[model samples]
Target: MEPLYQYAWLIPVFPLAGAMLVGLGLISFNRATNRLRQLLAVFIVSWLGASMVFSFAILWSQFHGHEPYQRTLEWAAAGNFHLMMGYTIDHLTALMLVVVTTVAFLVMIYTDGYMAHDPGYVRFYAYLSLFSSSMLGLVVSANLLQVYIFWELVGMCSYLLIGFWYDRKAAADACQKAFVTNRVGDFGLLLGMLGLYWATGTFDFDVMGANLETFVESGYLGAGMAAVFAVLVFLGPVAKSAQFPLHVWLPDAMEGPTPISALIHAATMVAAGVFLIARMYPVFEGIPVAMTVIAWTGAFTAFLGATIAITQNDIKKGLAYSTMSQLGYMVMAMGIGAYGAGLFHLMTHAYFKAMLFLCSGSVIHGMEAVVGHDPILAQDMRLMGGLRKFMPITSLTFLIGTLAICGIPPFAGFWSKDEILGSTFEVSPILWGIGWLTAGMTAFYMFRMYFSTFEGEFRGNEME
Candidate 1:
């Protein structure tokens, strides 16, 4: 590992500092004074943007696929067993740092336009900064224990951002729901960590991969026990990523501000789940049962999410379900042993999905000014039409995002989806069939939302 790789630990520091400065003690920024909010935004955008630049520097300096390396500050140890605070940088972590930081910095910029008038604007930036820190930390965590710690941090940030407008009952409830549902998965993940420790007495991913035989042949863990550990670990991603039955809370998350929606759905919250699986793939591969379950579960979630999206009239909610469906594809690809395919989709999906959600924010922002500031009425596609005539740029960009997610030809999604499906066809033609069907449904529902919101005459009541 190069000396420059040691700085990976610093990528999250600026944001945490910005969060503390913006919050300045976890209370409101002098209760809605715009100047303080403005100042805080400057601090955050400066710090987070700097962090992004620093991360890109790491990417540039460490672009070569190097052996795994770590920088640690020991936290605890029981003789031979150890716990530490640190980062693990490898090829994957380098790629993810670039993706997470890039999207986060852009979201901060977009928040300026979308959240300027809100009273919690200062605190919102505070939370956004912290969210970036948590996610970047999660990407480079050295072990399952560090993963859990930063995983919970990101989840906390999600709760705060989702419930940013706490005065609204829906926002408050959605935050609680997202938190509690994720807890169910987090507990399982914790148990998985504990089980791994019991079997091999280590928290480092590299150490665990080196000792898989000791876990099995040493008689400390049976094959079935290994599978259970893998399954328990996988449960976290399922809930966090909003797969199948645990997916109910995602749509309700629209109660938050829309850039936060992009933050959660596209860049940070849900993406963390898939990233974990990819990071842990070496361990996950030892258990066939875990892989089979993950593959089928992801396939079903993709299909189910697309179908429900077909009926949604709320624009953000529709995009939320689309995220759920897209995440499913990533998980399914990983399950079927298409590691590169899964991650390729994850990287591409982050770009396009964030664009789609931000464009939704732009639409809502314009409608609020036009329709007297009721978000519910503004976001309801039943009342929206012919928006392309007025907001042509947002409409055109949004259509490109829609096409990308729909796997249309010559778009980012088409290449990734084809790769996942190609990998799936080799693993299971039946699953590939399901994936293709979901892709068609994705195109249908997306176009449905697009036309209803931008093509027809305004279905909204005459407010002028």
Candidate 2:
């Protein structure tokens, strides 16, 4: 049998196959019986799930220490430049792959029941498979150029998934907004990549990091140029992570399917920004102004996202804004030089946010499943109350998510948030204070949204 490392490419390839299968099924069986469509959906999801599990098992057995493992296949090489396709397996990439694949599996499983009767079932599964493949490829990319290619692929997948229900104008609009906003940041990142290539003559992360000190000392790139490049690269992270003014698209993104929201918040779209920062931390650290800028932007965005989440009556939208706030905390941690803390928070956030979104999906699913219902009920929490009586499992899970997000002790969020805050103190007292205030507001708003959605008296009768 071939070694697992040699066949690592098959992991992402399997999902791409599933996507092709589902896409073909959609076109060929558009008018097919529901049973046939359901079978195809199950087949696609199952294949992707199996691939993920197999990849995880193989990776676990081969796990060593922090050093990255590379498997490169050359595509092109010329005098001083080389191009290749390969994977880089390190602690960070391994952790991200696990989080993304796990969340994708859960969401895919949940979709079977949640989207059982939807007409677009085949199309939905195809998009989900594509999204999974893109994200998996992104996490494993060996070079910055390859990473950028997969980065754009993931963004494209996000747009498709978010606009899956094209009949809904809000969904279409949200997709456009997200695509445009992220494109602006991507342009900055592209420029930064060009700058790095010009200065160091390489896009391989390891090579760049190894020679970073020499490049700086040779005056090929001064601190001012480094700061400019860092800020430009960071723009991509800010937009993708939903920090500050670029955050407008996220709440509206809740108009998409709940699973898409879960995917965005947990492992795919939003995480891209923080992943960039973590990937390029050494380069950013060389520029003092760039580090400070990251810290301040994160502080402001954290506070702003938390404050906005408090007033939203839409449960998923509130959670969306809250996701932005939590992401800001992660970015702030990276800005303060707490890479481990940022990643720790990212892992915990993935679990809890995914759980929260799925729980909300369950609630929405129930509301729409009332006997003999005609029009689907809205997802607005203002119209929902006393759901605990109907959805005990969902309510409990959501409660756990709420507490986790609020940074309550003993929960996952508490550990991560504390580390970020602790690290902030070493960077700046003002930033630490701002982070604390954000934490308090996060608690207040999350609980408010929770109580209003699950604890209050029933405000509307079940449709029949």
Candidate 3:
């Protein structure tokens, strides 16, 4: 069992292999029959399920007091520069392994149902497998360069998945918008990575942490320079996490399939920004002004997302804005120096937000029966009402997810969200006030979406 951890590299390889198999299969059977696709789906799910199990095993080992470990195989070198390929398994990596693997595993299964009839069924699973592999690789990356590589890979996968229906003009437009927007932030990230290496003389995260304070103390890294690097590094998260001003791409991402919304936007890819900040905490913590910027940015993003959601009638779009708000809440937590709370919110948000999106998928799936799959009409809340009677199970689960996101007690979100507010109040009451108000609006708009979707009279024309 102990030596099994050494084989942990297989965690990511399983899905990558599954993706390769599916990709090759597509070359031979571009339009695979339903049975063949189902078998392929099962294979993909099984491989990912193996990854999930390995992730939990690693996490379980960590919980039992196994020390953090790193493995490296030298990949490249030049004068005063080296690029190594490997993984670092610490508490953060373990936690993210579980989150990314679990959410992705579940979403893959959901995809089986959601994409049952689509021509792209097999290809969607392949993209998902690849996406899951990218995120896992990012989570366990040993160095900043590796993280950046996986980061861009994640972005590429997002572009591919979001535009899965490339023939659809909206899907093509949305994917391009996301790609271009993320490129802007990636440019900043590239600069910051270079700056960090310049400041610390290495791109290895642990080495950077070890050397950064020494450089600062010796004046090799000045305060002004550090602040610039900090802000540039944060831009990656700002755009990836859908923080305000860089947030326009996320809501528009609803043009993709619902499972993509659930997997990429709600649970995994969007959270990458928050996860990156958490990983780079040492760098950010050394700069007070940068921290203040993070906190306030989070507060404003939260409030703004909530306000916008209230006006949204499109179901996924409303949930999209809600995701932005919740992500803002997590970012605010990070800004206030509440690292644990911020990540706790990240974990809790993953489950509930993913559920909420899937529930919306269910609603839309049901609506297709009545509206004949007119994508716009099937997704409009104005056409949805009293669906609790028609979709009792989805309604019940959706209500549970709503309560969680709204911070109602006994739900997973309550404790995490309460901790964030508590931590914020200790730092700045004004920020806490904004977060508090956002909470109220979250409740109002969520229930408003709920009532508009599940309560009152059926608003669509009578079923034929």
Score each candidate by Cα lDDT.
0.87, 0.82, 0.90
| lDDT for each residue of candidate 2 in 30-142, tens digit (9 for 90 to 100) | 66634487777778778778767866865575474434567988879998677887987777877787788888888888888877778877788889999999888888888
By TM-score, who's the top model here? 3
| Model 3 misplacement above 4 A | 31-35, 462-464
As a whole number from 0 to 100, the lDDT of residue 300 in candidate 2 is 88
The runs of at least 3 residues in candidate 2 whose Cα sits more than 4 Å from the true structure, single-residue gaps closed, are 32-35, 62-67, 369-377, 462-464
For each candidate, what TM-score against the reference? 0.96, 0.94, 0.97
Q: Candidate 3's residue-wise lDDT over 1-464, tens digit each?
A: 56756788888899999999989879877765334999999999999999999999999999999988888998998986777899888899999999988999888889989999998898999999999999988898888899999999999999999999999999999999999999888899999989988888888765686687678778877878888888899999999999978999998899999999999875568988999999988888877877988999899999999999999999999999999998999999998899999999999999998999999999999998888878899999998999999999999999999999999999999999999999999999999999999999999999999999999999888644
- Per-residue alpha-carbon lDDT of candidate 1 for residues 1-464, written as tens digits (9 for 90 to 100): 36567666778888988888667644644655456677768888898888788777776756654566778888897887667878877778878888998998899999988887777787788889999999998998888888999999999999998888898898999999999999999999999878877776777775775576567767767988888888898989998999977888899889999988998988799999999999888788777888998999899999999998999988999999999999999999999999999999999999999999999998888777667678778898887899899889999999999999988889999999999999999999999999999999999999998898889787666644
lDDT of 1: 0.87
Q: What shift in Å separates residue 429 of candidate 1 from its native position after superposition?
A: 0.6
lDDT, candidate 1, at 409? 83
Candidate 2 differs from the real structure by a C-alpha RMSD in angstroms, to one decimal, of 2.5
